[model samples]
Target: MVKYNCYKPKTEIICSGSSEDVVGQYYQDVGRSDSQGDVDITIGEALQATALTSGEKPVEWSDAAAIHEAEVRATGRKTIMPDGITAAAQSAATRNARTTRDEDKTKLGEVLSNASTKLASDKGATRGDAESVMSVEKRDDPNFTTHPAGVATSIAAAVRLNRRQRPG
Candidate 1:
């Protein structure tokens, strides 16, 4: 049996008794590396990871509005506002949220790319080498996004929340 350590940090050791097992694990790790480098995680995964890492879920614009409404109601104020004003407020909030989410996604993508490059450096490859490999891999993968803004918005949003929650 061949035993090897996976490159992922904090991961358990892998043991393979056959060549096929080793190859399968290698491909799986590669796929995971690609996902991490692209900051591609599902909403559920993002939420879980964020909660684990930062102790809280990121609040979206809708959540903020809901909280505000609840607080206003708690003060014994009428919850009913003018329909046009409410609509306008909701529209603006949505637009601002979208803008912030898009920006955060971009930042997270950059962070992931940098992290991949750093990993390559740790393995004796230069930044340029890592970038070249990423370029080829992205080109080969039709579904890969260069910026990946929408693809990893949840993860990015979580990162933003963590930052905001951190004490100065």
Candidate 2:
């Protein structure tokens, strides 16, 4: 039999007896004792030698940390979003992501057009050829743009990003 102390700032709980007993109680303490919804808790088991003073015996089980850790383990990372947020909200946020993506591709095309015009004047290819190449590239890669000016203002950031990644 062993004793365990579970500590979260302002909440201290103790459980003694078997290792299973101590660990079970520790989970209970961190889960049910949290009053504020925003606190980040790290659950750890402490040996009796390094334990804090004895605390209340935990009777009920709290699955909060277990559930959260299960999700982190399954997903391999944490989300920026807070808990209790809906699946619908997550889906809603991406509603216009495709629209913005397409618009940015268009802007990237415009930048290609301008550079191509320069190539026609200073390099070997004509402006018409540059334009054709831009169209074909966009067909092959969805990220590229075919008519940048048409959507440049709407997705300036994407245009700038796509412009940097344009094929030579």
lDDT of 1 by residue, 1-168 (tens): 454534342133455557665543331232322322433222223323322442222333332243223212222233433332223334544555567454432222221222222221122122333243334334433465322322123345534543444446
Instruction: Report lDDT per candidate.
Output: 0.33, 0.26
**TM per model?**
0.20, 0.15
- Using TM-score, give the best candidate's number: 1
Q: Write the per-residue lDDT of candidate 2 for residues 34-132, one digit (tens) a residue.
A: 233422211111001001211111100111122222223222234422431112223322342344454332221221222211210111122332343
Name every residue pair that clashes in candidate 2.
105-145, 106-148, 107-148, 109-145, 110-148
Cand. 1 TM to true fold: 0.20
